[model samples]
Target: MTDEAFKREVKTLYVAEAEDGIRLDRWFRRRWPHLSNIQVQKMARSGQIRVDGARIKPEGRLTAGAAVRVPPIPDAVVRAPGEHQALSPADVAFAKSLVIYEDDLVIALNKPWGLAVQGGTKTTRHVDRLLSAWGEGMERPRLVHRLDRDTSGVLLLGKGPEAAKRLAGAFARRQAKKTYWALVIGLPKPTAGQIDLPLKKTGINDFEIMRPADAKEHGAEPAETAYALISHAGQRASWLALRPFTGRTHQLRAHMKAIGHPILGDTKYGDAVSAELSGPLKLQLHARRIELDHPSGGKLIVEAPLSPEMRAGFQHFGFEEAEADADPFAGVRRMR
Candidate 1:
């Protein structure tokens, strides 16, 4: 609740009827319940706020009544010494681009949602802190996989450190091939299915990872699958594509909020009940796509596109609006 009174607690909501696009940092931790959309996105990039006048991303969107501003929450730095210099200048003016695709092992970036490839409980600048401030004097970007702090898309850094331990051991055996594009809220009455269940970790920041309707914790033993591939309805919810094979911990957002099809503006499991997301919102999830196997054998893919508030709610539900101009990097670049 610091960051200068959380950007003077911005204002200008409307998107009623269960808060439209939602996601302005979980709508400013649900209109400021002691602030936390990661502290209103580290106070909207340390320049206070302004959505619509720019200085955006706290996953901005809150439609239905648009106008969100919320500016006034700066002053909060600490780490010094040229602030870990690399591509400094406040790390590309609070990271808006780092889209790499390097070689000689691996490197890929396109991520850009309140940024945090690792570090929680009130993050402290991540993506290994601007890739260790662009790895002063070279090679330091680790983390060969991780996305959540309001998931964005396609991140995989590793320029040394044994190619980040063989790309985090190929995402620990799952052979890395994620893929997501949520907009969920309802539908699964067979709208293309698969949920194999068997998850665990109830809570602790444990950051939710359910799937135990009590049948003795449903024989938990690592059983996830996510392979939907269809769901586009709207005006009420539906826009999946998921593809996880197993990578637990909020595995596709607690299995799409335990089959209730949450995901859309998911505030600790979507069901916020709007009123302007009360203040900041836009959950429609999106880590869109990812593929791997680049230890020199070739074939690696990355993707991330579909965030114009989930393409303006699929052009406000008017007959698919041509799937948003077909492949404007469709789900963020990944194909033969």
Candidate 2:
């Protein structure tokens, strides 16, 4: 073939099981490490790269079985095979140790508190970067959902493109159920009830916070949470179980605050009195359980135990951790 023809040749690739649910730019990066972000964005914007014959955004997600048309680039632009950065042994081991459950399609990690799920401004270390260490000889895992940096919980990763698509869909469609445990400064007046509050974000960038709003408020979205008192320490504080029906940023924390019992140690939502009573001041929320339909079939349930800080607080309040094992929403009617 002529040099000009070779340089203009187009190639088509099928999204493999492992590459599912990855961002379009990331997919290209994995295949062409030398492709700069600007090149990828330009390609996406100019329609040089198409997925299933449709122009897509760089942030668009890929699913298994999709066909991607990749325009040819000069060989000089490709990186040498060995030029990619290597994963450190320590990062790999730490990533592997967080795996509480793993299968062919997915992996669940008991993510510890203070661990960011994805990178951000001023945030260098995160689970998404560590996932690279686990991707050796396999497809890099993709995050389906996220937990707060200060919240410890069962975080799920899709092993491949197909699993990632299914898992992400489950969360988007509310097919997944999550249970959280928190130590609140004061007991909720009703003990067990639903908080059907609309929420709107306030502030800019990293300073953003979700607050209760009227239904007609601009950018307001409906959010509901079911909370039940599991135990209390003489009305001064209480251990509560929370189930969020709507996935809003900071739904649990904001809802708890709306009900006049912000979670203990939640400095963002709690008042000075609440913070003083929260003991060590570590955020007391823990994502204790998650249930969802498995990508392969049937049901999947994963649980994460409380962090040492929360566990100590639970013990001090005379709350039994085993009590959380029972259904927190058993008697309460679900309000969608």
Worst 10 residues of 1 by lDDT: 327-336
- Every model's TM-score: 0.30, 0.78
lDDT of 2 by residue, 9-78 (tens): 6755455433446689987875555678898999999999999799999999987546688898544354
Quote model 2's TM-score.
0.78
TM-score of 1: 0.30
| Residues 1-336, model 1: lDDT tens digits | 442343454433222212334467765664344454667877777746655455777776644333355554333354333322345576755543666477776767767666666544355566656764444323455555566767766677666655665666666555676767776655566765567765655654444445544435633535464545354554355666776666655678777777776776667766654212313435556666677777667767766665565565555443253353222223432221
RMSD of 1: 18.0
- The CA-based lDDT of model 1 is what? 0.57
Candidate achieving the largest TM-score: 2
Give candidate 1 regions above 4 Å deviation. Answer: 1-50, 53-72, 76-107, 110-122, 131-146, 149-153, 156-253, 256-336
**Candidate lDDT values, in order:** 0.57, 0.79
* Model 2: CA > 4 A from native: 1-44, 48-85, 136-138, 331-334
